[model samples]
Target chain A: EDQVTQSPEALRLQEGESSSLNCSYTVSGLRGLFWYRQDPGKGPEFLFTLYSAGEEKEKERLKATLTKKESFLHITAPKPEDSATYLCAVSNNAGNMLTFGGGTRLMVKP
Target chain B: DAGITQSPRHKVTETGTPVTLRCHQTENHRYMYWYRQDPGHGLRLIHYSYGVKDTDKGEVSDGYSVSRSKTEDFLLTLESATSSQTSVYFCAIREGQGYGPLHFGNGTRLTVT
Candidate 1:
């Protein structure tokens, strides 16, 4: 079975603080790793999809990097509005279902 | 923003009653998935549909069932509501094949008493 684990169940930071969230996974055949941001009471919003190791993708203040065994979502100088739960998920080459991590709840205090 | 919509934004029901949630997508995506989000457990898939009338079970699919009679609508039904089934249900969609990113609906909050 494919499993995903995210570290630092919860994180708190200042308005301009920069930090990174980790997502570790174990799967039979790595196909793609995904990052999503979910706000309170809303569904998860798509962030990025990393297909291969050493691949990196960025959007505004968020940068997602993937390695063979894990992925990291780096938040650069996050703002108060950036506060949300970040989710990581992975799908194997043989499966269509995504195994999701527990998620990292981030609080950016102003 | 992929035009996914989940109905019954909030629902309150009693145990032993049947409940059905609807997920509609305007983008004509080929794949639709039903997932439940709980406090401790992350998003766990309940069921998924690859095409019309094509359905499959997920990791946590014991008490749930799904149907996809149309190309744009997918439905998840619980045989009997239970307190343990209270969760935020989200529907996700993907257009083509491959391991592409999925776009999710706003979610439906279900509370079983």
Candidate 2:
């Protein structure tokens, strides 16, 4: 069974604080890993996609890194506007359907 | 935004009543998906259509049904609404497999009383 687990269900950080959210997965063959940011009362916005281990992608203050069994979303100098629920998903070799993690809710206090 | 739109952004319905949600996309994508978001369960796929009239059940498709008569339109129907079904529903579309990202609609908020 393919499963995705995100750690630190919720986190609170002051402006400019740096932290990382973890997403671990168990699957037969990893195809791709996706990251999304969802705000309150809105749909999720696409962030990055990692196809292989040791791959990394960054956008502004967010950086996503992937490994053999897990992925990490690191937030650097986060601001209040960056506060949102971060989600991670993985796809197996068989299909395009994504198995999503429960998400990590981050709150940046200014 | 991917030119995706979900009708009746907010809806309140009574339990046992049948309701339908519409997802329309102008991007002409080949894949469409329906998902429900709950407090702690994350987003669970209800159903998805790979092409016109080609739909499949997802992990949480017991109480939901989907129809895709056209490439740009996908509809989700709840045979009998229940309190447990009250949640925000999102629609997404992908151009093709391995494209990496899905364009999502703003989502519809449904409340069953």
Candidate 3:
């Protein structure tokens, strides 16, 4: 079965602290990995899509990197406003549907 | 942000009532998806439409039924609302296949009493 797991269910950090969230997957063939940021009571916002191992994408203070079996979302100097739940999903070569992780809730205290 | 809109942004209904959530897109994207968000569950796919009159179930489609009669509209219906059905529903669209990112609507908050 295809499954996605994210580590550190919740994290609390002070403003300006940097941290990394991990997303691991077990699937037959990896087509793409996606990262999204979702605020409370709102839908997720697209962040990045990594297609292959060693691929990385960055936006603002967030960077997403992918490997053969996992992906990482690194936050640099995060602020209070940057606090949100980060989600990771994977799609197989069949391009059928996305399997999502439980997501990591990040709280940045100012 | 991709011109996607979900109707009945907030709804409260009694159990056993029928409820329908609508998703409309102006981008004319061929791929449209419906998902439900819950605490600690991230987002779970409910149903998706590849094109007009073409739809399929996703990971969590047990109590959900979807219809796509036009290029821009997708509807999700709950035959009988349950307390477990109270959740935030989201709609998404992808322009094409292959590794493109999905654009999501604001979402609909549904509560069952």
Off by over 4 Å in 2: none
Chain A TM-score vs. truth, each candidate: 0.98, 0.98, 0.97
Task: Name the runs in model 3 displaced over 4 angstroms.
Answer: none
Candidates in order have lDDT scores of: 0.93, 0.91, 0.90
* All candidates: DockQ: 0.87, 0.70, 0.70
Error of 1 at A29 (Å): 0.8
Q: Write the per-residue lDDT of candidate 1 for residues B2-62, one digit (tens) a residue.
A: 9998999999999999999999999888999999999889999999999999999998899
- Reference-based lDDT, residue A16, model 2: 96
TM-scores for all candidates: the values are 0.98, 0.97, 0.96
Ranking of candidates on lDDT, top first: 1, 2, 3
Model 2, A10-50: lDDT tens digits are: 99999999999999999879988999999998898889999
Q: Which is the winner by DockQ between candidate 1 and candidate 3?
A: 1
lDDT of 1 by residue, A12-35 (tens): 999888999999999989889999
User: What residue runs in model 1 are displaced by over 4 Å at the alpha carbon?
Assistant: none
DockQ of 2: 0.70
Tell me the docking grade of candidate 3: medium
